[model samples]
Target: MRLLIFLIIVVPAAEISVLLLSGKTIGFIPTISFIILTGVIGAWLAKRQGLQAIKRVQEQISYGEPPGDALLDGLCVLAGGIFLLAPGFITDFTGFFLLIPAGRNIVKPLLLKIIRKMIDRNQITIYR
Candidate 1:
């Protein structure tokens, strides 16, 4: 909750400051165009990655194997898509990484390790 509040307040202010500086240096039209281009490219990459992840998950299900990492990849792709839709370079760069298969694989293990530790410590609970 606190993180969310900090992100909501800080991210926009930071983005606006960066945008202003970029606009001044590169001109407003070019800055806006760059943002739009990043968004379009990010969306395209996200869609491609999302479909691949889904297909992999389906294959795992059919093989009676767990799709643990695939699920995480799908989540990263979704987050990337959302971030891309938001107007900011920092978010877009992070989003681009999330949309990449290699990046997803790298992040998945770290996330799983953290999750496992939390579960072991009983720090997280599922209602269902």
Candidate 2:
């Protein structure tokens, strides 16, 4: 809750400041264009990665193995896509990070740790 509150206040302020600074340095048109460009690239990357994850999940299921990792990858890609769609430098950077395989791999352990904590706290329940 505290983290959420902090993000709600700090993220917008930071984004606005960054956008203003970039606009001042690069001009308004270029700044807007850059944001749009990132969004377009992120959407394309997200779709490609999401399809690959689905393929991996299908392959694992066909082999009678759990698709846990693939599912997690898909979730990350989905979240990245969402973040990319939002208009802000911070979100775009984070979105691209999650969209990239290496970046996702780097963050996966942390995400898994958080999820485990949630489960332990009974905040989340897995049915199957």
The TM-score that candidate 2 achieves is 0.93
Task: Give per-model TM-scores.
Answer: 0.90, 0.93
- Relative to the true structure, how large is the alpha-carbon lDDT of every model? 0.90, 0.94
Q: What's the TM for model 1?
A: 0.90
Question: In candidate 2, which residue ranges exceed 4 Å CA deviation?
Answer: none
Candidate 1, 8-121: lDDT as tens digits: 998889889989999999999999999999999998898899999999999999999988878888998998899898897888888998898878888888889988899889
Screening candidate 1 with a backbone cut-off below 3 angstroms (N, C-alpha, C), the clashing residue pairs are: none
Model 2: weakest 10-residue lDDT segment is 5-14
Clashes of 1: 0
Predicted structure 2: lDDT: 0.94
lDDT of 2 by residue, 1-128 (tens): 99999878988899999999999999999999999999999999999999999999999999999998898899899999998988989999999999999989988888899999999999999997
**Model 1 misplaced regions, further than 4 Å:** 123-128
